[model samples]
Target: MNEKAWENFIVKNQVSKDIPEDIVMSWKRSVRAGIRPDLKKAPQILNHQDIQHIASTNLLHRIFSQLSGEMEKYFNKYDISLSLADEEGRIIASFVEGQLKETLQEIRFYEGGHWNESKSGTNAIGTALAADKAIVIKGAQHFCENWHPFSCAGVPIRHPLNQKIAGILDLTSVNELFPDNALSLTAVFVQSMESLWHAELLQDTEKIRQEFKTYLKNIKEDDVLAVDSSGGIVDKFTKGSNQDIEHLIPLTLRNLKKGENKEEIPLENGTDVKGRIIPVKRNGRMVGGITHIRKERSLGAFRQEQNSDSPFSRLIGQNDNWKQVIESAKRVAARNMPVLVTGESGTGKELIAQAIHEASDRKNHTFLAVNCASLNHELAASELFGYAPGAFTGALKTGKKGWFEAADGGTLFLDEISEMPSSIQAMLLRVLQEKQVIRIGEHTPRSVNVRIIAASNRDLKEWIQAGKFRSDLYFRLNVGRLHLPSLHERKTDIPVLANHILKNIDNQFQIDACAMEVLQNYSWPGNVRELQNAIEYAVLYARDRVIKEHDLPGDLLNNENQRYSMGLHLVSNEKNRQSKETKISEEDQLLKTIEACRFNMTQASKELGISRSTLYRRLKKYELQV
Candidate 1:
């Protein structure tokens, strides 16, 4: 139904047959809650601290960590945004993709926003929580006019142990028509989340058991008990009766907070026992606790070790060739000689240059990168060298400092050096030789001490032979040369590189063996940059933060398949060549027989033991007109 029908129902208090019963009931409840039909957005009830507290909850953290990747996939594929709301309808987290972010943000559909029926109106998150089931609210089915343009499907997620409504999982879209399977998909998602919740509980229990075992090694206590987060007993070791330990369990659970707490409990046998209960935590959330009757010293504070690796450590690779290149770069960083970095496109030439600058004594100064290929031909000279005041038309009145002057006392990275104009190359060579710069329209040369690091993906020797690059300038920059190998040349480093990229994006993310195998087998034409891009793409589409072969980019898989098919084609071509050779030998035999028979078809066919029609067919096959 259209907005007109919705307005009719709101103004006349008449329910339309087109509206579902659940929606009609929600509309009545919304009116009774004193919700305004023109409410612009949901009320935000949580601040930064509140949101942080909600996010720190173990259950919420586990749910988001497990489902966010799949939610991202759905959003990317279907243009849908997913959200999780607490039992009270306060938005806890949201996974949004596509251009609907602005629209959703306009309505305050984000973390800390309250969307209960009383606060906002009839909507998926609110109404589903109210109904305690899965539901779909499409365009104009909402009680608020502001939400009428959106369609949403929501399912309530229940706690695995208690079976109480924990939160609502919602799928929202700005499309004109709601997805027919949106409700069912949401239901399935909730089911998966519920299963994950159960799995998390079991995992937490197992972790608590392990922690207790570690504690058991030190503790000389005769009575000990392990309890989960819910105060349920997991395991117990008792030398005496179990009744005294049972009485201490509740007292231990009562003071179960952070750190260790000692509790004194009086048993029914008129004996008092002293025990210490330590809470076990995972990801900053308490999972379970261990209680034992023992006297122990206070725990020592933990100190984290600082990383002492040099700046070059950022360049991640384990290949022997790559390590050799890095070692050479490190050695070159000690000297102030001109360095030239050469590599194929996307092979991280710029990264090596940056690493050199950061490792040098001039690291504290500015490190400027200029793409010679992107520099305008007309302005190339002016951009590299400072321009005098009123140097030319549209020149800055203040006399702009070029990259060389700007990067003085530091390092200047000239990328795509082969693409630089010949005139600029002459100027660059002069700067390198003279240790100074002469700005355009100025006679007095400026004495600058700037280190140069030039990089190119093309072979400078070829460019010099072609007369495209100046050989003198090449010699000046080639004092300390480092050539980076392509990704294909270092196949063994793919897994480590992929894992490092994944760790930077999300530490919880992991690459499956199949996905890593696909990456290792593929030829990385685009090199490291392409590998990073592929990892990021897989991270976005992966499920449960586990990247699989199917989650990799289509181009990577297609190229791998194409390479395999090309190998098969090569083998088939070899077979065809052998078959053609055999046919040529047979043709030679037929020709000799015909010659021996004096060009008689009947004689040739009879001697060859074949019919005249067969002889004619053989001749046609070999294109022998005679």
Candidate 2:
């Protein structure tokens, strides 16, 4: 053929009508691999044991054994040879007749010969496997000059279970003897093999699933679940009570490796369940897994780990605003009335909630916390009210108990109440009023005895007025309210809080006077959470155990405006002004301060010398940025 013209076409990267697209692409790949058109032969060959190893380890070899006779008889008329190659394109089996078999053997087209595109340039087996499609490489289309005398047709064989290419099926003959429909025939055979293999795999999976179910039945009256690697439940069995098996496990549970195991899994009901994971292996590789749930036992309590001295004591502050809020919380916390704690983000709403739970009569019971903003409307509803079996698509066959049931006789802290969807807000109102929760898809409402502490950074009153929240819900939630002060409103507490935060870190850190001043001066828009973050950042980067002004965030330095000064004087101005006109002017000044500080409640509270929650109330009263 014309090497010069092909090289020119490759150099110009032009497509030619004479060459098929697949062949043209293969030629480009071969050229890029530094292959020469005059190369005498393809490289690489395996010994007998290596070929036997590949055949023994894969299902493709078994399938090939059944196909060999039919393939040999059909290609005998054309004087062609049929070959089967493993995923790596090494010939593991072949069927040939007479002189054509002899011709193929001379060219190392026998068992143990490798034919990958990288080594063999371009041949039917290699290129077909590489592209994962059936194709024919005729005469000069083959890259190696030695292969130019033959026409080869091949198709990739894929395993039906995992959809991975298991091998390649090929038909090769001298150019004159190549059949007209060789490529199509090979593809049809591979498809049939894959279908048959899939049927066998399904049978095996069913048998194994039945074995697992029987094992669970013999061991205990519990559930056995099998999940594929993709987190889809392949099979499940529920014994004794005959209730459907429930998969109340996270998708992350599917990531358990072959040997890695989880001994204890905590359920929403504050009970710990013992389980063992059995990894399913095929050919020494993890394909899926089965989980056998043994039994459920109540633990002391199941709460998220907290970085606090004691629940109430950790709600630290020496200021009057802090003192008043704490006193009010302690009084009503024992009363078992529903409470709503308001504050800016990171201003310790969760801390107060935890403290209330600890100080209340139900201190020893579970304290469950849920972030309303983190979940969607439907999910929030289903999570808080539980879901009956078949409530929605992909729902667990067995029903699930919601947070209300799980936190019975304890406390349920719903954070970010302002972000709760309108539909969920209405449901919550009913739950609070009736003291019962109706699970999705269930007509009956179950009674729940749980104290709720709803928290929000946003003003729910404004949300109600805006038609984004229900006023009735607001009224029900407003009974026992405590608004936490922002760090800016209580600047005097910063030094103490800073020390407490630093002590938690293992390393000793000394704050330079300038850095301390920077911490105090900057308006903490993110409130206490931002302060903790800054301290962590400084502690991480502190050189010689000292935090300097330069070590602080650059935003803190540039944040100095009239508003920053206002934060320092907020308390004094409030104390000095008692007249109605003065109050109106002060309200405008507070508005200006908040706007100047980018409407961050914590920052505005600090400038106004008020609590973050108080600032939220004011924002609601004026309907400004509500």
Best by lDDT: 1
| Clash number for each model | 0, 1
Best by TM-score: 1
What's the true lDDT of residue 210 in model 2? Answer: 54
Name the regions of candidate 2 deviating beyond 4 angstroms.
1-310, 560-626
In model 1, the Cα lDDT at residue 152 comes to 95
Q: What are the runs in model 1 whose C-alpha is more than 4 Å off?
A: 1-308, 566-626
Q: Give lDDT tens digits, candidate 1, residues 378-429.
A: 9999999989878999986546678887677788999999999998899999
lDDT tens digits by residue: candidate 2, 2-79: 444455554686656777788888888887888766666555488877764455445567667666645645557238
Model 1 CA lDDT for position 540:
91
lDDT of 2 at 184: 82
RMSD of 1: 23.3
